[model samples]
Target: MEAAPAVLTFSPSSSSPAGPRPCRVLAGPAPRRARALAAPHPPRAVASSRAPLVVSSPPPPPAASGTPATTPAHAKVDRSGRFCSPRAARELALMISYAACLEGADVVRLFDRRISARREPGYVFDKACLLSYNHMSFGGGPLEVGTEEEAEKLTSQNEMDSANEAEVLSAPPKLVYNSFVLRLTRELLVAVASGWNKHVDILDKIIPQTWKDEPVARILELCILHIAMAEMTSKGTPHKVVINEAVDLAKRFCDGGAPRVINGCLRTFVKDHVDNTGTSQAAESKA
Candidate 1:
């Protein structure tokens, strides 16, 4: 026997099985790398064609209870470097005179009282009346205009002027008027008082019989006449302008044919008194 081939033998360690033991898979969580590789991806969002909705904030609530809303006073319009216009003074004088006539009191004293009268506590004068006062709203014939655009422009301008005049007239005498306006108003009041006394007899002759019978109803018209005559007598404003202003006042304050009647009366006054006075003065100067 040839020396027998040496047989190779393998030995196993104490902790592990010998030779090709089946792959020992321990029952435990998978490795982090293996789990990450097996995870699924989320889907992407789709694009839209619809418009986005917009949300707006709500309006503020009204004022608290017991608190009244107040209107702001309008600012005075300064014209020709004057705070108040002569027209405004004339309007104020007319109002004061009308009030005096109603109360059967002295116009100057009434004016002083009005100027000095105190405002009530927490009293807010409603200037809305002043702003909304439209002379045309009182009633008048339609305006003659060439076109709608022209009519609109004219109407807008007239409204602006009327509102401005109303603001000036409505303001307190001590606050709104400058020295010139105050002096002018005082002089007008004095002239009205004196001229009224002097022209009391003349008014009867000029006014219609119907008006004469109802003097109470015609107080405004009479006041207009007195103011116009007083203003004319001062020789400050032109007689034509005075007459026009008087007619306008009648149109604004009086109804029906008052404007026409006022115009006729003013013309008559100019013709009878102003022209004669001028003629007599000129003759005296020449002599």
Candidate 2:
């Protein structure tokens, strides 16, 4: 067969083929090993598993008509773009008091400028009462709860001090306009500062962990509740209304869960201080 097939020989130094030209060897152990090594390793399979369970808060209450409430025309917008609802005279009062405490501005001057210009400003008598409360508790000066008649005395005394010469007191407190609301707010401020320890005691008993763990975070909530509980002590408004207003305020200024915490604290306060006899147990004790 065309001169017997040449037997193939292998040598490292040889460069040419030694077998017949037409014959070829394609399946060899060395080539198989090379192909196996060159091939990519397949990806390993991971076991399937379910995601971890998570506890979530309940959904928020539904809106009345799925529309956001509009701000009242009387609401005052401060330099910082903070709007206080016209009905939020109490909030405005506290804001001024806090400003007085932190900014070192005279309480009288701040009230004259900020609260005086409101659409339905609180009674000057109530303002004087607030000034007296601020002085005694924060200012550490004196406490003098003024009567309705003292409204005139307060006006005449501050007449020369104010630019609005027509009105004896620049911001004369309203007589019938939200009187209960103003009284509630003023009393709250007074009770909070004057009875600071008592409120703290109530908070300590109700939510001790909050006071101990996150005192700073809960400061606003505590202040709101302090005022709410103070308002409750007067017996002029129902407990539910006080709690609702406190929760609403917390929702506005505080982070999530604040409203719930406030509600809890206020409910506890009501349980302890309010009686079915339609009287404030706390007030009766004071009397």
lDDT of 1 by residue, 1-287 (tens): 76542221111111234422121000112221112111221111111212322111111244689999642222233433234557657766777776565445666767778788886687444444443333232334444444555544554554454445445355566655566767777788877765554455567677778766555556677778888987877645777889888887776556678889889887877776665432322224446
Question: Which lDDT value does model 2 have at 51?
Answer: 30
Q: Which residue runs of candidate 1 sit more than 4 Å off their true CA positions?
A: 1-76, 79-83, 124-138, 141-171, 176-178, 276-287
| Native-to-model Cα distance after best TM-score fit, residue 203 in candidate 2, in Å | 1.4
What would the per-residue lDDT of candidate 2 be over residues 140-223, giving only the tens digit for each residue?
A: 111232443443333333332222212212233342224444544454555444444455556667764744454533444555
**In terms of TM-score, which candidate is strongest?**
1
Q: What TM-score against the true fold does each predicted structure earn?
A: 0.56, 0.43
Clashing pairs in 2: 122-173, 123-173, 123-174, 124-173
| Top candidate (lDDT) | 1
Worst 10 residues of 2 by lDDT: 132-141
Output candidate 1 Cα RMSD. Answer: 46.0
What's the true lDDT of residue 267 in model 1?
A: 82
CA shift of 286, model 2, Å: 6.4
Looking at candidate 1, the ten consecutive residues that score lowest on lDDT are 24-33
